[model samples]
Target: MKNIIITGTSRGIGFEMVKLFAEAGHNVLALSRNSKPISDLNLKNVSALSFDISDESEIVKLGGYLQTAMKKVDILINNAGYLVSKSFSELSSQEFKECYIVNVLGPATLMRTVLPFMKKDGHVVNISSMGGVQGSVKFPGLSAYSSSKGAILTLTELLAEEYKESGPSFNALAIGSVQTEMLEEAFPGLKAPLLPIEMAEYIMDFSLTGNKFYNGKILQVSSTTP
Candidate 1:
């Protein structure tokens, strides 16, 4: 069984991912700002950690703790993210900075911290957005969020190239509008979005296949019937 680490497990997609992975017999290190709500599940394979991913110092401490624990992570899912919608003209500099901190720097910091402890056959899954795709239309108030996800896509490609021959794999998953807290936060008027459990299931299935065809490529997930 794989030892997987997933960030942002408090709710939504991250929470569902934790449940799915643990049920699949993998040992999951689930981290988020808050404890997972399903505390009653009592799964022996799941451990919950709480920390603010935007804080580099906290992440460094987590890295030290993991090293001391000597638990090698086979999969790293950079799933924690945020979205603050405001028109470019109305968005303050500080707001943009905060977006970058959580959406970009957090993942970068985690990847750096865990790199040394990752096994040769490890996998890195970056949760990007459909907005990151080329020529994607811009949402009026999503400049910061879109740009950050776009950067993540580039980062994924670069990492995949860097690790191509060294072992392990890096890929970016461009998720479409999924029913999650973030989506509701971005569009409060919308009645419903894609369910989190469905998305989580698809992601877990994709990861377990050991398919290299998608490595260094972006896999987009949407609710549209194929």
Candidate 2:
């Protein structure tokens, strides 16, 4: 079984993904600021850690854990996110920093720290948003969130190129609206075509098998108009 690491596992798709991987007999490291939800599951193959992606010290702590426990990582899924529905004019500098820290910097730092533990054939899947895609339909209140996600999309491509000849593949998924808490927070009363668990299932499959066929690629996963 592969040694897998997933971020933002306290709820939503990330939470569902932990269970999926563990049930499939894979060793899972579930990371979240609030680890109680996963810890309560008590899954045999899953280790739940209270992780703050924005903290450099936490990343260092995780690296030590990897060295001692999970000698190698087969998959790393950057599924954690931060968002706020505020107009561009209303978004404060601190708010923007918070969004970027979680959506871009955190993932980038995590990948750098985890690369040494991943094999050449391993996969790194970044969870982006449809709003982040260039030329896609845009929204007014997501300036900070969507722009940060866009940054991650570019980061994924650059990393894939840098490691193309040496190691693990990197890919980003620009997913459309899903019935997640984040969605409700951003666009209340809006009904999405997909559910958190449904998206989790798809993401789980891609994290395992998509690397062979795709790297430095942004897959737009949406059924609605572009």
Candidate 3:
């Protein structure tokens, strides 16, 4: 069975991913800021880790745990993210910084920590957003979120090129809104046609086998339901 690592396991996309991976019999290292919900799942193949992605000290400790917990990770999905919707005039600098910290830097740091443990031909999928998709769909109050995803797109391209021969395949999924708490918060009272379970299935398949021939791609995974 492959070893998989996924972040943001407290709920939504992360939660569904853990469920699908463990049920598929893969060894899963599920990380979340509040992992108690995952622990309650009681799945043997899933190991829940509690820590915010933005917390460096927590990430360092998790790195240590990873050293002894598994010899190789076949997939690393940087699925953790944050969003704060505010108009340009109302958005604070601190909020912008925090958004980038969770949405961009956290993934970068985690990737660095887990690189040595990645198996040959491993896959790394960074969860991005259609909100960040250039010239496609633009929302009014997502400057921080959009820019952060743009940064992720760049990182995916650079990393894919930097380790073309040795490192894992890197890609970003610029997904549209999926039905989740995060989505509800981002656009209150609006319903998304896509579901978290559907996204999880796609991610599991991609991480397990589909991405072997792809690299540096920023795929727009979305249903055209506006």
Candidate 4:
């Protein structure tokens, strides 16, 4: 069983992923800002760590903690992210910076910190969005969020190329609109978003077997298979 690290586990997709991986007997390191509700399924091999992803100091501390563990991380899931939906004109510089910090900087920093502890067969899965893909339709209030995710896509491609010789794969999953806290926060009145647990199950399965086929490709997780 692989040792996997996942961020943003307090709720939503990250929380579900922790359940899925732990149930599958993988050693899971779950990180989030708040302490997640304890689960019997996760008690076996899941560890919960709390830190704000947007804080560089906190990430550095986490890096030190993981370094001390000295165990090679088999899989790293850059799943912690946030969205602030507002028109470009309405968005402040502070908001843009905050988005960049969480969406782009946090993943990049985590990847850097974990790289030395990753084995040759390790994999890094970046959680991007359809807004990051080329030819995706533009949405007015999502400029900052889309831009950050788009940068993540580019980072994924670059890392895939950089680690090609090492045999550790890097890929990005441009998930479709899933039913999560972030979606509800973005569109409060919207109904029928995909459930977080369902999406997490799909992601866990994909991470186990789909990397060989999907490395460096943006796979969409939507209701209808394309």
lDDT, residue 97, model 3: 93
Expressed as tens digits, the lDDT of each residue in 126-220 for candidate 1 is 89888777676666888988899999999988988887887468888888888788788889866444789988888887776644556777887
Off by over 4 Å in 2: none
Question: 1-226 in candidate 4: lDDT tens per residue?
Answer: 9889999888889988998898899988888888556343447888887778888888788878887663679889999988999999999999998888999998898898888888767888999988877787668898889999999999999988888888578888888888788898898977645789988987888777766676676776555332
What C-alpha lDDT values do all the predictions have?
Answer: 0.83, 0.95, 0.88, 0.83
How many angstroms is residue 101 displaced in model 4 relative to the true structure, after the best TM-score fit? 0.9
Of candidates 4 and 1, the better by lDDT: 4
TM-score leader: 2
Q: Quick one: best lDDT, which candidate?
A: 2
Q: RMSDs, each prediction?
A: 2.0, 0.7, 1.1, 2.0
lDDT of 2: 0.95
Residue range with the least summed lDDT across 10 consecutive positions in model 1: 206-215
Query: Which segments of candidate 3 are over 4 A away from where they belong?
Result: none
In model 1, which residue pairs have backbone atoms overlapping below 3 Å?
A: 179-194
TM-score for all models, in order of appearance: 0.93, 0.98, 0.97, 0.93
For candidate 4, the per-residue lDDT at 56 reads 80
Q: List the candidate 4 regions with Cα displacement exceeding 4 Å.
A: 38-42, 224-226
